[model samples]
Target: MSFSSVSPSPTNHHQMTEDEMTSENSLLADRLHAMLHQEFTSYPACPDYTSQADHSSTCSPHSRRAVVNDDWRRKICEWAFGVVDHFEYSREAVSLTMNYLDRYASYAQSKGMPLSRKSFQLAAVASLYLAIKLEGRNEQGQRLTISTLVELSRGLFSVELIEQMEREILTALRWKINPPTAAQFIYHLIKLFPVEGIYDVDAKRVCNGILETSRFFSELSVYQSSLAIEQRPSIIAYSCILNAMELVGPVTLPCDVRQAFLTRIAGITQLREDMMEVYNTRTSLRELHSAITDAECGLPGGSSSDANQGTYDTSMLASTRVSPVCVSGRQ
Candidate 1:
């Protein structure tokens, strides 16, 4: 079930001229921004249930028995990351999976139905399964099958049960499965802000590095419920880029230019405080970058050595968890 062997090599697009590349990047950025705006207006919140009584039992009559705290939620997401990494699913898949879990949990809570601890992992797995189908594919360009997913889960679930859970999740979510994820926003943002004055070759390399590193941080953000649920995906993506820029230590923009860029990002996301909170507290950019390098360079025994390697050992990532002080502050 390991996806390591089937991982696709990076595609080269060197045939495109600089102007054409910029045009393509700009078009993509516009599309992503438009999609985010559309989602914001159409699904201001997770789709609502048809009836109040339709709320999950764990969030209703058994509400008192369904008290899962943020720490517990973080642990569940961490475990999901382990599952995602072990199977080599895309980071987008994992982030989108957590988005479903969080939004559904939030919607249920709003309806006075909080999920019980016992059912949380089921929801996580179902969300993961759905996200893989939505955002991941095998070398043969086919989505992972239920049997493969079941085996990946170490036989903890059967095909029938997982299918049932998936249906329940979709029902509970009111079929609003496609939401803007941090990774999506980050991809667009990187295109919008290219490295200045570099040749096409070097610019592409630097841009890809920033995108990959920002994506790692964005994936890590999924485990921090306070940040993930509270901030818009664009805000999270913007913060990640800023952190990535810091780590990459590229040429600094002029003060006024930097201020203008921040202003533009703030206006787009409209969650400046949340963005700053994410930057200052929710993630340690330096430590995360180090962990990614360690995982890539095989600092951890038998880890993958490919520079473009996306999957990493969950153990290496566990050390890069958000600071306890940040978690306490959120509480």
Candidate 2:
């Protein structure tokens, strides 16, 4: 009975007969409409409705139905930024992709391209995949794959046979995403401990190994076409990398995984030395940027937007895109 909850039913047509997938799709569309109904309905005629709590006073009859779909999309994104999102990075990345898509929607319109909210989501998921790949990791089969994403998008559109719509959306978004380099993630991570100077020893140590292992794993990647990339890794790769660092220098390690770490990290001779540089550079940059920004702190929206803008930008998000996916309840 709570909004956004569509109880699972066996005939989930996204898995069965997709054309018959109307009920669930309608529920999602309706949920979206409910969330952003005000924004959609109050356009043009209802200018002052935005200033009022009960927006119904100014919405036109014709505008109400059509805009409901758009409002529904806006609501979905709001929900995504709320509960259920796992990583701040993921949320930010997806949000940016959505905003770009919204802007591109205008472009698509100008170019006579048909783009629906569902098509846009596919592009966003594809962007997520490419971002992960550029960030130097990958997922298989069940995640972010083109076919799966297209199927996942089934419920976000209308029942009007949108086959060409999906194709057009894919055409508009020629698979591209901006990957934050390791240094970018590292710089941001270091800020969580914000005081700057020397990072915690273990944190510094693991970062070094992450870079080394990143290269090591990059080489190993050639053979991975045969590996099930989506297979849940034994431990999150970063956690595994941290444990690997315990193998280096004064740190102790289990003989086996330890030996593997040393072997893998050996690909880069300057491993420890690089850690020192990363630590120094991050520490110094943090101080420099902090000093510069602190003076600009109270300049209206400047500091606030500055705080929110990191590797990912989330300024124009219009909806939450829940994966029709139910991964293991693991965080």
Candidate 3:
């Protein structure tokens, strides 16, 4: 990027006025983002649909996801039951360090390298460095000793390599990551009206976006399942990581992450087909009302209690995925 890209312009960065800072920061990051995204191997930019979408006249999208499809199945595999397994593993210092690293991300985005906000993979410190940086205490406001970070990052990137890779990683993400995350998806999904909302002049889309993203999530899960088969962790864990970013807000993807997602997509295509099966049936309006009454009151002859228990996911992803956006923070 041009040095001017990093520097403030007279028209833009005249001073640190709130309005000026906001605009300048946005423009600067745009420039840096443009520079970083020069090399993207763009593929068909659509969700594979996990074969969740039926081709036959027999099955409709509504019937597919509404009735037999297992949304919880995927959500459960990744985040763990009733708990955030990842956060549990994190130390206070670790969270503080991630926050600290994120501070740098804000700094990077504000200054002109939208890199940090765009590519979280680029944001990861080496596993070792990350551990130390995340959870160390020294009187000097130091967390994770420097020696520790160095030891972890050493193989990933040498002192010299760290500089280049850091820049490159950020650059790669600028090319691929986009805003609107899975949490956003879940939010809209949960808030979704039974009917599609439309404004004739413009046409508004809501859970529609998640339609595509849902497919991606399914594909991601199937692919991850294979890679992580009885290994360190499931590939689905990465999906959880990405989804957590959504939970935290803002979705950025490193170019590497994009490639990884796509690779998983291919692997998942087969797996998803095998794992997901579509049925061609739907309850009539009367049938639906009866089922709803039975489910709501826990009436006899209803779907079993065990069936309803799956809805207890506290990840926020579960509760909100089917609803439309309410007031922001999930209650």
Q: Give the candidate number with the greatest TM-score.
A: 1
TM-score of each: 0.65, 0.29, 0.25
lDDT of 3: 0.30
lDDT of 2 by residue, 182-288 (tens): 22222222222212222334444444433443322221211121111111111112222442233344322223534443343333221332354334433433343
Point to the candidate with the largest lDDT: 1
lDDT of 2: 0.33
Count the clashes in each prediction. 2, 7, 16
Using TM-score as the yardstick, the better of models 1 and 3 is 1
Candidate 1 displacement at residue 5 in angstroms? 49
* Per-residue lDDT over 1-331 for candidate 1, one digit per residue giving the tens place of the 0 to 100 score: 6556564434323534656886885677577768679557744544322222243334665643355666567666666665555455555676778778877776776777767665566677788889888866743466767786666556667788888988988987789888877787877666555346454235556566666656767766676555576666766677777765554432323334444545555554454534456666335544544564665732232133422232323343333322222111123
| Candidates sorted on lDDT, descending | 1, 2, 3
C-alpha RMSD of each candidate structure in angstroms: 11.7, 23.1, 20.1
lDDT of 3 at 185: 26
RMSD of 2: 23.1
Local error of candidate 1 at 153, Å? Answer: 4.9
Q: Tell me which residue pairs clash in candidate 2.
A: 32-72, 33-72, 74-318, 76-319, 76-320, 77-319, 77-320
